[model samples]
Target: MGVTGIGGLFFRADDPEALKAWYAQYLGVAPDGWTPWEQQAGPTIFEPFARSSDYFPAERQHMINFRVTGLDAMLERFRTAGIEVVTKAEWDSPEIGRFARIHDPEGNPIELWEPA
Candidate 1:
């Protein structure tokens, strides 16, 4: 059979332990060597942007999109936790979804999407 789904996402971090802990504490993502986070089943987008695509930042090589529920609550939580979240009215639609952006301590772009 072909690839089933994303098996893992591995990347380098300036302070790996701190980064791992940050993900675990804020996003509920399991840290390295712990039980892999069990993401709820849903749609996954796998589009390759053009070199000059301005959808996300140009400095970063990749942007990860994580589907979520309760978009408003999550945004509020992030704000209360001192994590800046960016949202645009134009990015949401009845057909697509709502989106918000945040960066990790290392400045990696993360997109949180809530399906419409």
Candidate 2:
């Protein structure tokens, strides 16, 4: 019984309330004072990126990857909500999954993955 799953993800937000609301609206994540959200049981990836990796913005220290289902539907929703979603054909793999990228209002990179 060493380290378990992540307890939470805490980050500095210039406008915490606005960011929370954005997440709630676009990603369906509950905001402050709301019930804690639980993810369905699944594989969670925990890998470190190289300091010079071009996979994401170099200025940011970390990028958050979230497991998702119905990625096409979600992307459509994000587009309808005016959220810019970035995707590349090369990023998808039959062995792994499909991927899409988007930045939060705070400019943090968030990766959405739909396992194959």
Candidate with maximal TM-score: 1
Q: Candidate 1, which segments miss by more than 4 Å at Cα? A: 31-34
Error of model 1, residue 103, in angstroms:
0.5
lDDT of each: 0.89, 0.89
> How much is the lDDT of residue 29 in candidate 1?
82
Residue by residue across 1-116, what tens digits does model 1's lDDT show? 89899988888899998999998877878755466778788899899999799988998889989898899998999999999999999999999889999999999999999998
- Residue 82 local lDDT, model 1: 95
Shift of residue 75 alpha carbon in model 2, Å:
0.6
Candidate 1 global lDDT = 0.89
**For residues 51-83, could you state the per-residue lDDT of candidate 2 as single tens digits?**
999999999998988898999999999898788
lDDT score, candidate 2, position 24: 81
